[model samples]
Structure formats: C-alpha cells, structure tokens
Target: MGSKLGAAVAAVVLALPLLVGAGVAGIGSALFGGSGTSSLNCTPDGTTTGTVPGMTAEQMINAATIVAVGKQMGVPEPGWVVAIAAALQESKLRNLHYGDRDSLGLFQQRPSMGWGSPQQITTPTYAATKFFEHLTATPNWQTMSVNDAAQTVQGSGFPHAYAQHEDKARAVVAAVSGVRCQPTMAGTGDCNNIQAPNPAAMTAINYACGQRGLPYVWGGNGPLNGDAGFDCSGLTKAAYDAAGISLPRTAHTQYNAGPRVPDGSLLPGDLVFYGPPSKIRHVGLYLGNGKMLNAPTFGQPVQIDNYRYPGDDYAGATRPAEHHR
Candidate 1:
C-alpha cells in the first residue's frame, strides 16, 4: 500500500537499520488474521488528537476516517495500526485524485486493477474497507510487521516503506480511537481497562476466556462431549453452563431464550448474537470495550474480537445471568 510518492523517502529511511524482525509466517488464519487468543492489556482510555504531531486538519480527518472504518468493520486496534501506517505510506493520509500509474486514493489502489471503480477507490470509507478486506485475507497478517502486512496487500515496489510509519500509525490510532495498544512478544497486542463484569456473570466470562485457542468445530462442544473444540453457540452454552445456568443448544434457540439487554447497554458476560432474528448464526460472550469471546468459524479458534463489524448481521445480546436471577 506504499505510494510511489513515499517510496523515495522510504528508500532513504530503509538505508538505516530497522529493529523489527519479519512477522511470523504460517500461523493459522482467522477472520482478521491475528491470534486474538491472548488477552490485550489496552483500554479505550480516551482520544488525544494533540498527541499526534504535524498533521494538517485534512490529514487528521482522513486518519480518523480510516480508524473509524476499521472500528466499524470490527477490526482490532492492531489492524487499525496497519491500516493507518499503510495509508501514511501510501498517500500520507490524504485522499488524492491520483497516484503511480492508475493508483488512486489513500492506499493508492487502482481502479484498473479492480480495487474498485475510480470513485470507490477515492472514497475514504470504501478505500479503507477494501484495504482491510485484503489485509484480513492475508494469512497471519495480524502478526506481520507493518511493512510486511501492507506490502502483502499493496504489492508495493517499495516493500520496506510501511515500517517507517508504524510508530506514527500507532500514535494516530491511539489519538483517534482513544485506545492505547502495546505490542506483545507474541506479536499481538493486549487491551486493558475493560469495564468489570457483573459479579454474577464472572463465572461465565472466565469460563469462556479460559478456552481461548481451542479450535472451532461445527456442532462441537468442548471436552464435555470429548471434543477438543467448540462452535459459537456451543462455547456460550458451555460457558454459561459452568456458571450453573443452562442455555439452549443452538444460536437461534439461545436468542429466543433470553432476558435480552438493549443495544449500548451491553455488559461483560452478555451473550451477543449475530445474524437476523430468525436465523441467528453466531454468538459470543461480551467482554466489554466492544470485544467478544467466541469460537468464530472453521479454522479460527476461540478468541476475542470486536463484536460489531461492517455488514455483520448483529442480532442483539441477552443476559443469561439476569435470566436465571
């Protein structure tokens, strides 16, 4: 995603030694490509735009748009960092009418290459979403270095360019999203300061959290049925079951059996359901700060991810603790 405009600067910078190693390859892929298995130590601490230095108002707005799009798409803060860094390297965070060859917009995607029509590629929201779609498709992209991740998506001639912007990208993401993310040794970042779960709901939350990294199996229940993995509803059902509450076997049935919580009032331990009301396809245990613990899909593990994403069919949430109370 590095723009030709930034390539010259990147070449000069790449002459200096870089401290970051190559991102690990061959890890199993997830919906967004990172291992959400580990807990993040970051929190939505509050936005601080002044902390990001030397950007014009337009640039800042574009940067915020990128972050906002990432959030809307249920991308994690790390993904936001990659998107911002890619944007910074590509067009310096400016939505432009032109780039190298047919390239256009923030990431310099090209209409001729099927990134989109010229109009769609130039639009900030459309551009960011397209970038994330490619990014999340890259295997182990979440663990890739900024340069590597961006290059994987952009196929840039200047492959090393994006790394130079990583620090600034992290800063931009924090400034815009109010979430401070610290990269972990495992090549993932942890978020902290999530609101505490209701005391009565802790057992369920703890049970679900403890099952991170288990495989996702269709109609499978963890251990209770001698299966090593869990499907979405199976995880939630087992989690609540550990808390002395019984839940129905399937996602739709589970939603029907609810003491439903309203939107914007989701507490930790709420069972967040997705898909239409008549055909809820997935469920996750809410873990606050927009994260949820669930068995996402085949090949993905039980892990934490943003509960909401662009075009995700989010049904609603239910409080099993309240139901039993």
Candidate 2:
C-alpha cells in the first residue's frame, strides 16, 4: 500500500498533455455532450487526463471502485462526480493509510469525528461507501452543485477546493466505468428523472413512484392487492408485478431471477440489492439518478432515498427481463 501510494504521488508529480488523442479528451466530450467548452476527455486504452494529469493505474482502479460502490448503493452519476472529485482533492485518489488528525484513506475521512474506525475508514471501498452514504443523506444533495454537495458531506476546511477537480473526476469516471458522466441537475434543484429506454421500465418506475408515502409493513404484499403496505422486497415485487413481471417473495431469490447488471450499468427499473452476498435481505427498484423506491423499516413510509442507507450493506443488482419486453 505504501509503495503504491508512492507510485501514485511520483507519477502525478509530472506534467502530461491534457489533450490525448481519442482518449479522455475526445470521448469525454461525446458522453457529456459537446458544448465544446468542457476540457474533459479519455483515451481508448482508459488513461485519463484533463483537470489533473498523471493518474496512475492504481489511482484509476480506486476511482473505478468508488464509482462501482456508489452505483451499488444506488448513487447516481452526479453523486459519483462529486465523490471522485472530492477524492482527487483530498487524497489524489491514493488510499493513504495516514492523514492529518487521524484522517485516512481516499476521502481523508476522520475517525475522531465518527467517520469510522481506522481500519474501516482506510479500506478504499468502505471509505467511499461511507462518503456516498453521507452525501446522499444530505438534503437536496442531488440538486446541489458538485462543490456544495461534496462540502456538505466532507465539511472540509477547504470548501472551495473540490470545484477544481470536477472535470478530472468526470473524466476518471468515464475512463473507468466505460460510461460517460451525463449532464446533471446538481445546484439546479431539479432532481428530474432520466428517461427510461423502454416502456416496461418506464411503467415499472412509474408504478413504484405512485406508491410513495405508503407505510412499510413487514410481509405486507401490495396496496393494489389485499395487503396494506409493503416491506422492502414486497415493494419491489409489487412494482414489477404491476409491470407484468413475476418475482419471488424473498430478496435473495429475486436477486437470482435476473441477469446481473454491473453497478455502473444500472438502468431505471433495475432491482438493487442490500445485505451480504446471496443472503441479501432487502431490495428496491432503481429509479435512475442515484435514487430508489423503497419501503424502509417500521416507521418510514414508501419513498425515494439514496439507495444505500448508512450502515446498510450493498449486495448487488439484477436487471429484470421485463425491461427488455
């Protein structure tokens, strides 16, 4: 870890041309839409440059993990933009086992402030998950500007620093995920829906949204049927059922029913899982842009939330076949 961290620092210490042929600089414009003003771009081989150059392979790998974990947690691409930007600013994408005042890992999360223990905070995946969980919980996070959203989560002494890294972060996410970061509603107070590619997916997402504000009841099946409310899996099952797809009762079984969607490739109406491996205990329907339709535990009503709650584990995801139907 120390040597890898050193390699990252040494590589970044040099200057590289921001404009690489058909890589980060070229492809990035297409993914983000060519306003012809943005400086982001990516190489076909996946090396990225623009905002900050000399990104090492190890750093890129960590950036990819952060994006993937955010997706697994139901974080939208914008959320990923903020996360990567912050990581670049805080640690330069290096998962340092050390930092000022007990700060550690990719985001420089602090243990003294209750971020987590040194071990948990230092683990790149765990640190990124913790960061996104806090970020998504911030009110109107999806609507806040990249810097504002990052500051809301990190509360860094240097609040303005994150802005400098957004372009590079977007570039990194593009290179690593094989998906370009799209335009976001950040800072605009419009967490608007991303259009579903097909009718069945649209229908299922709409059905789930229609049930918002309903109470959560354990083992409760459906509001349309006889049952009063719904549990986590119950809500997902019922929503898909309305879209004409059949799903098993338990979260684990439902997870096994469909082709798995990689976290970075999630589409609207996909099933998002939470818990441990095949033992997944909860499920929700992905609604694109980092939110999900959930029937949370006892006291909470059916609503949209950042897919992974604090301390809520991310299992995996599956895309229902109905979406293609």
Candidate 3:
C-alpha cells in the first residue's frame, strides 16, 4: 500500500454529493402514530410505544436519537446500523449513566478516555454523534461487517458481542428511519440499484464484486496472479484487466497513468485514489452512489465502502475505461 511516486498535477478536490433519500414512512406507525413527526423527535414524550417489538419505548427513543444524529451528519444507512448495534451491545440502547470503569451512555464510551464528560456522554444525541464520528473515521468502515465496524470504533474487550445485535440494530434503524437496508459483508445494500456507466464499466464492477470477501494481500494480484487475494491497486488493476484495460502496478503510478476523471463527475468503474499525489497509497473501483469496491488494508477483505469518509485522504479519480476507448 505504501508504494510512493513523485507528484503529478495539482490535486483536485472531489465534489461528493450527499447520499440521502426519503425512507419508507410509518414503519413505526404503531408506536409513533400516523404523524411521522412524533418519531423524528429524539426526546421522550411519554406517548412513545414499543412499536418495534421487543424494545421498550425508552430504547426505541434512544434508537431514534441514533438514527436522527446519523441522518443529520449525512451518514448513510449502514453507518446508522453500526452505531445502533454498538449501542445495543454496549447498553441495550439505553443511555445509561454508568458502565465498566468510566464507560458510559448508550455506547459505553469512557469519559476518562476522551469520549466526553459524563453529562455529554449521557446525552443520547451526543453519544450517538460521537459514535458515528468515530465509526466514520475508520477507513473503509462501510465495507466492514457490522460487528467489525462497531468494534473498530468502540474497542470493546468483547469484540464479538456486537454481531449479536446487528439484526436488532438494523431492525431498529428501519423502524425509526423507515429505510430498510439489506446490508451484506460484500457490499453496502444501498449500492445495488446504482448502474455502471457502460458495459465495460459494468464488467469491471462485476469482476471486482466477484472478488469480494477475498483477503487483502499486499502486492497480490488475485487468483490470476496465483495469490489468495489483492491489494488496493492490485484489485483495481485486476478488475480493469478483466475489462481489457491495462493499468500501472502501484497506486501512485496508476494515478498518474489516468485519463483523469474531472472532479465532481465520477462514474462507476472510475478508479478513485487516496493520499497526496506525491505518495498516493490507496485505490478503489468506484461503484457509484458514493460507494466503491476495494481491497482495503490488511485484515479487511475485498468489499464495498463509501468512496469518501471523515478524515479520508481522497486524492482524485481516473477513468481507465476512458483511456481504453
């Protein structure tokens, strides 16, 4: 991942559009009543009900807070699932004022560990916001399994515990936000409807998607190269190679070897890059709707993730298929 090359042209700041949409309304109508306005309020208003089944009114309200904060931050539905799942495992979606050591609130975030003060950490909105912030900061988090993404942010001793709550968490998110996300380890559920720009792009995307769940083997070129999996540039190279387009072996070289895609105009199958131009380190195959298919770092497999995230060092994108044409 650290194959550095010299600088190319000035960096282009990408214009990523916010991915938001109207979710199905009244999924929680039994609890929230016909007026959807009631569910939007994160604060408990005494009229709350266990419309989600198995969860109490208070737990549902906290879940609602988590969903609301994620939407306000423009976090995609998968992120909300991760946040809510972490909350479920940590505090059963209740905003508790006590936990192991200084761990507190719905996420059991430690006040002593810089999560925030007890008062702030106990606040439902504040806790949910903090959880989402950390989750989004994790590189390629959208590609990670719900438990893996939750553990990456929470750093819990019981790392595997978060997985148990994912179904419930996803259910809570759907109930509160009315958006049913069919999240899979292979890709974010939101990207299924996104169409590739052309047959060639579609071919490349399909090729990459087929490689999902493969390990991230640095310098590996996938099964065709006789390795188990792929590296960032290796996966992109292999995907385009399947589409009959040749690309440079490393990320920096590939960035410089582009029919450079203009900023704000990325299309599916475009090769998105990260890090400075002088030392580009990461690359992924754009899968449209702000999602990408890539072999993210060691321990992570080939999977789909948002192309942009908080603290991401996105460089730019290149349309390799354009060069082929």
Candidate 4:
C-alpha cells in the first residue's frame, strides 16, 4: 500500500509538467555545510552565502542524504540550499569527524547543545534535519533573513558568511533538484494519479492565472473576490475557495494540515511554501512543467514561474482540501 501510494504520487509528478505545461517542482540536495558548484546563472541574493572548502566527496554524499531528508521533512529547495550553504560555511560539507573543539559532525554541532551522538551527526540526513529543525524554532526567524535563519539554528561564529554561498546553493538546487522532481498530473488515479481539484482550489489557481496582468494589491482579492488584484497568498487562496476547497488563511497553517509531499513527486495545484523552515510564512499554487501562477508582490501581478519567491525558502508542498478531492 505504501509503495502504491508512493507510485501514485510519482505518476502524478510525471504527468504534472505536461498537465500544467504544465509545471511544478523541489528537492533537497545537500547536507549541513558542503561546497556548492558555483557555476550557474540564477536569482541574486538578499541573504547570507555560505562556502568554505575542503569538503570530501564522501562528505558530499552525506550532504546528499540531507536533500532526501529535507524533501521528506517538507523543507523546500531554497531552505535546502541555505542549509547546505550554511553547512559549507560551517564545516565544508565534510560531516567532520569533529568540530571547533567538541563540536562534532557537520556544521560542527556541539554535544553540549544536545546535537546527538557523534555517529548520528555524522549521518548526513541526521545532521541536516538537526540544522533545519533548529532553524524552525529561531525567534523572529521568519523575518530575520536566510542565513540568519540558519544562524539561529546552527549558532556558528559566522552569520554573514552564509551569503557568499547563496549563488552556489541556487546552482546546486537547480542542477540537482530538477533532475529529481517530476510532478504528476493531479487526479489520474493509477500510479498515474491525477486527483481532481475540489472546485474552489482549482478555481482559485486559475482565477489568479486568468488575471495574469493585473496589479498586485496589498490585501485585494479582486473587487468581488476574483477580478482585480491580490496579495501574495490571498490571490491563490481565494481561487481555491472558488474551487470549493477550504484552506487555512495562512501558509504556515497549510503546512500544518497536509501530508508532507516528498521532494521527487511534485504536482500541479500542490501548495508550495516559502520562508523559514521553522516557520512557513508564504505560499503559492504550483502550475506545472516548471511554472507557478502566483500573485507576487506590490509591483508584480499574478505571473507564472517555475517556482516560488524567485525560489527562496521553498519549504515543500502540501495538497489543499480541494486537491485531494
């Protein structure tokens, strides 16, 4: 049953891009502190970049385990990149046999901080989750900054250093994630599952997409709920309501409600989240192939893209009530 569920999810992923054009996406691809590829064009940063050096491939493989863990834990690619970059800055992704003094494993987690046994920290996924789980609890973490989000968790000596690796992290995410993520066509039901939308969510996603060129309003959801402009999550949420689905008013709440999607099986209409892993603060509806129809901010209108927030803090996906219908 579990394998069928997994395959069903996989089928939905494979058909999604075709369905959306269709598009959707995410995947974790590194562990705490690993060096990034640093050779691709991507969105610039408003955050810290982490990169040190001396990461062995063995350590790199460990970081890869985090990618799988992040996807499973609902951490987005952006979060994955940030976590990886921070780890790179901290331990060079080596999953160090030891830390600054007694700090052991990747990111030099301290035994004093309750990081776990040395072997656990050495396990790539264990280390990454420890980092992410800690990040999720930082105070004011949501609004602080990306590297800052990491800093709150890892508590490294360097907060500014993480930014240097942002581009590299972005590159890694692009290089590794795309190859793995394959959104399915929602409602197909075989391993080819393409679950139908409940009506309101589909309407919500389409309505915003339909108003492709409208101005983005701070709190507007059209003059009558589906016409004019919309705030970030508001635009997508209203459309979902139109489709007959009920969703919590905020992105964080959305994360709390659904079955966490694994990274490799993304699909259209999947709720993509952004912001701190510890605190989900934003969301968008996935379209497919590689695009998302969203009500971007103040100056932007609902536009299509391969991911959310130029791909920042993507905390993974969830199915809204309508999506399961």
Compare the candidates by TM-score and give the number of the best one: 1
**TM-scores for every candidate against the unseen true structure:** 0.47, 0.44, 0.42, 0.40
Q: Write the per-residue lDDT of candidate 4 for residues 1-325, one digit (tens) a residue.
A: 1233233322332322111110111112221011211111112233211111443434344444445445544566667777777777787666678657788776788767777666656655457667767665565665666677777777667668887877665554443342243223433211122222223334455555566777888767675755467766676677677766676766677777776778855655677888786788767777654556677677887777657445376888887733432
Shift in Å, residue 26, candidate 2: 40
The lDDT per prediction is: 0.70, 0.68, 0.70, 0.55
Residue 118 lDDT in candidate 3:
82
Candidate 3 residues 149-171, lDDT tens each? 99999998899999999888877
Better of 1 and 4 by lDDT: 1
Worst 10 residues of 2 by lDDT: 182-191
Q: Alpha-carbon error at 119 in model 3, in Å?
A: 66
> Measured by TM-score, how close is model 2 to the native structure?
0.44
Q: List runs of model 4 lying over 4 Å from the truth.
A: 1-56, 139-142, 179-325
Cα shift from native, residue 219, model 4 (Å): 47
Per-residue alpha-carbon lDDT of model 1 for 126-153, expressed as tens digits?
A: 6887888788889998888888988999
Predictions ranked by lDDT, top down?
1, 3, 2, 4
Candidate 3 segments whose C-alpha is farther than 4 A from its true place: 1-194
Error of 2 at 214 (Å): 33
Comparing 2 and 3 by lDDT, which wins? Answer: 3
Please provide, for model 2 over 231-260, each residue's C-alpha lDDT reduced to its tens digit, 9 standing for 90 to 100.
998888887787688889889999888789
Ranking by TM-score: 1, 2, 3, 4
